[model samples]
Target chain A: MIEEVAVALDVGGTGMKCALVGADGVVRHAERHPTDAGRGPAAVVETILSVAEGLAGKAYADGLTPTALGIVVPGVVDEARGVAVWSANVGFRDVPLRDLAAARLGLPTALGHDVRAGGLAEARLGAGRDTGHVLFVAIGTGIAAAHVVAGRAVTGAHGAAGELGHILVRPDGPVCGCGRPGCLEAVASASAVARRYAELTGTDTGTATTRRTGSASDDGSAAGPGRGRTMVTAAEVAARADAGEEVAAQVWRETVEALADGLATAQALFDVATIVLGGGLAQAGAGLFDPLRAALRDRLTFHREPRLVPAVLGDEAGCLGAALLALDQMETP
Target chain B: MIEEVAVALDVGGTGMKCALVGADGVVRHAERHPTDAGRGPAAVVETILSVAEGLAGKAYADGLTPTALGIVVPGVVDEARGVAVWSANVGFRDVPLRDLAAARLGLPTALGHDVRAGGLAEARLGAGRDTGHVLFVAIGTGIAAAHVVAGRAVTGAHGAAGELGHILVRPDGPVCGCGRPGCLEAVASASAVARRYAELTGTDTGTATTRRTGSASDDGSAAGPGRGRTMVTAAEVAARADAGEEVAAQVWRETVEALADGLATAQALFDVATIVLGGGLAQAGAGLFDPLRAALRDRLTFHREPRLVPAVLGDEAGCLGAALLALDQMETP
Candidate 1:
């Protein structure tokens, strides 16, 4: 008998992480494709459809029955309606991705927000697996989160839930990409850290050091991806802080403090048992975790301090989560 | 045939609102009793048990079958285990209220948190009735919230979810009863408005205006209730603001701004379709809603602004919620 698999795709701004995942969560096959968002959303959609068909065909050739298709994209996704409502990077506005994929592939399909999908995977299979309630914060160019409860991520009423990055932390802080002043993303996101560090060090954003591109990295801003396009990465700032550089240390402290404040607010609202940190900034590891943990503790009162841990699934969490989402939909239906 | 009903109790700091509600949500009978919390937790427990038993007896005497009992209390509740983990007003510490009520009344019992119960009722049957996702905020001496998704309140991992009031908003603001500085509760609660007004007017808290005694009102703080004893009531402050008093206007503006900030954060995270405002201050009607709605709209960017509405359930919401809880439990079981 052939094993059953889910055709999954975790679409980001610059690249798409595609995979064939078994029902047991094991990856049978995986591949990647450039999104080339500059070519526009229509081209991107076509590319996505083509990639999904190829993967489905690959599964058949490998003697595996493709049970379903799952696609996770950045931006506001109405998971219930199977629509990609709005995305800044992909230029999607009310695109019925689920139905399109389902029609094109002739399989049951699940569409989810990328961060939410990643968070679901993290909560169910990564660092938050032991906890029933998990908050997955991905600190890339723009920060975003997914609140996973009992293994299901909450997609807000408008399919825009878990916008942790936009929550106001500093009333007079910098303006966010969303045009809001003092948003958490503006103060603590990887891009924010790098921007602030550059502002202090007198470096330019257009021409500077390269930001690393992860296997499944996502830039949640509407403007698009920022890979290899920064004066300095958040990791370099962390390194500088560790090396006892004054400006870098100050920037790092400010970033950690803002993140702690944001996480503290999330804790008060969701009361999750664990918070998993992911994305480019999370690559700093202990350098980010130690200070973040202490700061989060100091801010909490009667609220239980959430366990702060790093996401262990690396970049493939989103693809795995896409698979999980498809499996979940099938089970529920 | 005897009509089946659920005996419900909404326990607050100063009073207990008791009721018998049918499965269709119609109230058959209702009454209130003074809590006299100064009598301590043990005596309070006994009183509660006696009251619930009496209600059950009354149901039988009135030709209605008492099917189950539901009780809502303030503070940290472990709903899964039916334990009133900790409550400042009720002085509860790990009291097995559900089991106690169950044993006494010989009926299945459900224990719930007060604000969450109110939120549940509001979402299912009141102002939030039209929406599937709602955040019910009770702004009394302190602020608290319940995130209701599809008529179910999120109890969180530790039964302590939806602590919106404790979220940090004004980091430079006053210290809260919970020993935290700049919490939304400290900056925007009814008591905060009254206290700020008093400070501006130089009125002493021990002897001035009286905060009204509300039915089914719970003070959600570990430091206990602060009602009737405040310097000036938030209602009076609202009146002053409406009368164009500069100091009162400033206080009201600050409160509105903080509340807007808090709600925006909630919207960014929960993306609910509606926000139901209840408790003492919401009684201000348009005075609070008009400006609050505008402020909230100003703060939102990509997120949809939740419909700001006053809770229509008034005092019986908690009791009704308790009844609903029992009914939900029975059905699930």
Candidate 2:
């Protein structure tokens, strides 16, 4: 018997990545394109449909038919209603992506938040596999998370269940994009780390600096987009620290402390078995993982200590997660 | 057809309550006794077994042999392991309550945390009826909560999922009984409310105040024994406040604010449809509910507001919930 196939797509603020994933979880064909999200939802939808169509054509040529299509996007999404209630990145309000994609591709389709899709992937086959309760936290351009309980992602009543970034860590610490003061995202996000570094040292090293007297400039050129003026990006800071930069080390220490603070709060609230860290910051490996683990341990006294690990599926996690949802729908239907 | 009856017992820090509950959701016979928990786990277990035996004997004499037994207690209870991992009030440490109850009663048994059991009752037939996700927060001698998803209470991997009272609200706040600073419980529990009132005022209510300030007496002498000179019972504070005492009013305001803060955080994290407040302090009716509602409303900015209501089943909820779990076990087996 031939296995089924689904075309999965993850639409982000910067770009969209699509994959023709088989029942065996292998991506047979893949492609990517800039979202140009500011172009409005319709144009973005067109791009999504065109790329999905291309992937479907490729699958057909490979002697496989796409049984369903799964697409994941950012912002507050109503999975049950198949409506995108709001999307800060894509200028979407109440866009029924599921029905639109189904109409466009003539197949069963599902819509989900990008973070939840990643959580589903981790819950089913990655770090959180088989865990009764798992939290998948993604930190990159911004911080967000998704929860899986009993092997299913919790979409909450309003489709805004996993807004970990908005969780108030500091009631009046820093201003966040959500117009909130002292949110976890405002302090612990990758962008926030870099921004803090720049604010501290009065140098724009693709980052922000804090109120610390230190400098870790491995290379002479600290002047770059978000870097070189003593304020280096979290990446630049990490690199400079790796190359024995003093200022970079200070910034790195603060970043880990902030991440641990946010994560400790998450652990206490959910008390889950595993926490899967994904997105760009996680790519730093030990630079991000080691200090974070130490900080979390120091903070937790009564709550169960959640095992922290990097997300396994890389960039394909969201797409594959969506595919898994579609697969469940197909099998049950 | 004759309805099956189950023997249910609720063990509290001060006393034990037992009932013979019918499958039709009605109590046929009820009784109570002092828990004497400080004597140790063995004595507590004996009291529990004797209570169950008495209830079962009454049911049998009434021409209905109890089908199962349900036991609900406090502290960190591991339901899957059938053990009461630890309970400061019960003097228990890893006591196999389920197995012991089953062995003593000669029937199948189920054990669970008292608050979670009450939450199960509320979710199934009370305030949260028909709600998909419900968080039942009980403010009493100690603070705790239970989450019900799809009419089933979620027991996390370590049975520590709903320790809401321990969530650190202030990093530099008051020291809690759990040895943590600024824990929700340390400031919100019935005892905490009274303790705070005492700390603020120089009068002592003659009772170890529980969270519910509504039951306190006007004069400290009438409250109870074993209370400190500067400590008024939470009940006494509520009583004075009811009579328009300014000091009592201030304490009440702060208590409600802290409860609202904790609830708002829980609302943001869990997004449950309803929150059922139970236990001792919940007995305040409008006094507690009205203020908490207003406070929660003031804090909520971006989350779906869950309906707040007093638990309908009152003290019998835990017994009924335990019965339901036992029945579930029987049916599944």
Candidate 3:
């Protein structure tokens, strides 16, 4: 008798990552590939199949046959139907990715939402490893979260659970992509922070990056104002604040304030034991954690102050989560 | 070898109801008495004790000595502490209802929020029976709800999980008792409906008890200013709609619209299998159900249409739910 491995694939907006995981949750082999999603769903599916096959080859070389496969993607996924009902980034609609993968790989397959899968990874093995109730929030391009209760991620009745981003904050602030106004996403998302800073400084800054402010200079400090106008992103704002930039300091304060407000509302509702912060903005480290914690403490009165910690497993979380789903499917059936 | 009965009491703003529930979930005896809450927490506690004794005495005469007691009251409660933290109606603040009852009745005791208890009863033996995820909403003089997941009510980390009424619906509409503007309670509650209609008509018709339309003589049908001015409570409003009152028809339409908006928000966030309607306003029967369904259908596009049903066990639900909590306490210790 031979023990078989499970292949986990995570497809994001930019790239695809795959890993071969054993029954004991060890990643025996891992690989990454560019998604090039602008070529559409067909190309993306092809890339997924190729990457999965590549991972399977590696596992076979290691003298193992993959028993099952798990794939996680962004957007509205109909997990029961094994279809990605709609996806904005990958240009997919009603694509039966599960059936395609199962047939191509000759293994049982499962599909899920990327953020939810990542949250599942965190709940099972990351920052919220021992927590019974956990909420994993990804604060990158836009804010989104997934709720994991008692080791199970609630997919919701209509498959739209843990959409903390759309929870309205100001009720009359900026309009959101979902056509809602003043959503938490509109205020606290990393993209929102960058947009707000760019709007304030009136500069078309390149990709936002962090830099130390160095001293308490009013106009500019270590990172001099390029073209008499210092343009900065969320990361830069946080870095400069740590280094003592007055303008960056103010922007950082506002960003933390908005983030706290949104997190407080989430606290009042879910009362999750731990809130694992992930995605781009969280990379700011204590620059993000410190003020965010202070803001939450200031806003919360009677609600539980959840332990806010950075997510473990990073970009590979979604892939691991998807693998877990596939493993569970094989065992249950 | 005989099972002992327990005294279950539901303390509302206006009255207190008692029932002797056997271990098998049967109500062996039932009684009601005025709460007279204005007399303060001391008086209310005394009333609850006296009523429990009466119910216990009846159970004893029937060869079943009560072994435990359960009491449910309105407002914020610290169940772990066995204290009624705050209840404006009963004027109780940090009052140890469970300890008081246990000492008085010489039995194990349980105390809980009134609406949450009702929700538990619904989940176990009423409309939400067999449903793992249920949201029990009580739209009465004030509005509140309880989320029942896996047949257990979620008390939240701060004991304020089911405060659905406090969710802001309108950003600048009417003011709510919680000092917020345009809360779900202020917009969709039964009291809000009557108050709104009264404000428009400026007639304190003293609890609109009947629904009436204009004479049917005009153009072979009821058509006039009074056709839409149904002089009735929500119950009478339903009756008038049944009897073809044009005025009551308008009022009923507004009620459904408001409720549907609120419920739609709940549906999007909770994604529960069923939403059980309870409390005083729920007495409208089909008046509430028919229009609410239509309104929900119109508003929802990607959400599950929750199965809406009337809460069974009526007012006794709270007591039974409290008993369930008591049973949990007994089993755990």
lDDT of 1 by residue, A1-333 (tens): 889999999998778999999988899999999999889888999999999999999999999999999999988889999999888777788899999999999999999988899999999888999799999998887788999998899998989899888898998888877877888888888778877888898874543222221112454221224435546667888999999999999999999999999999999899999999988888888989999999999988778888999998888989999999988887984
Residue B157 local lDDT, model 1: 84
The DockQ assigned to candidate 2 is 0.33
Candidate 2's chain A scores what TM-score? 0.89
Number of clashing pairs per prediction, in order:
1, 41, 4
Question: So what's the TM-score on candidate 3?
Answer: 0.73
Candidate 2, B241-308: lDDT as tens digits: 77899988988888887888788777767778889988778777788899899988876665668899
* Candidate order (lDDT): 1, 2, 3
Q: Write the per-residue lDDT of candidate 2 for residues A302-332, one digit (tens) a residue.
A: 6678899998888778888888877777877
How close is every model to the real structure, measured as TM-score?
A: 0.95, 0.88, 0.73
Candidate with more favorable, higher DockQ: 2 or 3:
2
Q: Tell me the tens digit of each residue's lDDT in model 1 across B129-211.
A: 97999999988777889999988999988888888888889888887777777888878887778778777888745432212
Q: Total backbone clashes of model 1?
A: 1
lDDT of each: 0.86, 0.75, 0.71
lDDT of 3 at B318: 84
Give the candidate order by descending TM-score.
1, 2, 3
Candidate 2's displacement at residue B254, Å, is 3.2
Fnat values, candidates in order: 0.79, 0.33, 0.25
> Best by lDDT, which number?
1
lDDT of 3 by residue, A1-333 (tens): 666899998887667778998877778888888888899899899989888877888888889888889998877677777888777667787899999988998888898888888899999989999987788888776666787877767776555666666665555666655555566666666656665666666664543322110001011112222324454556776787789977667767876876776676566556678889887788889888988998887655434588999987787788888888888897784
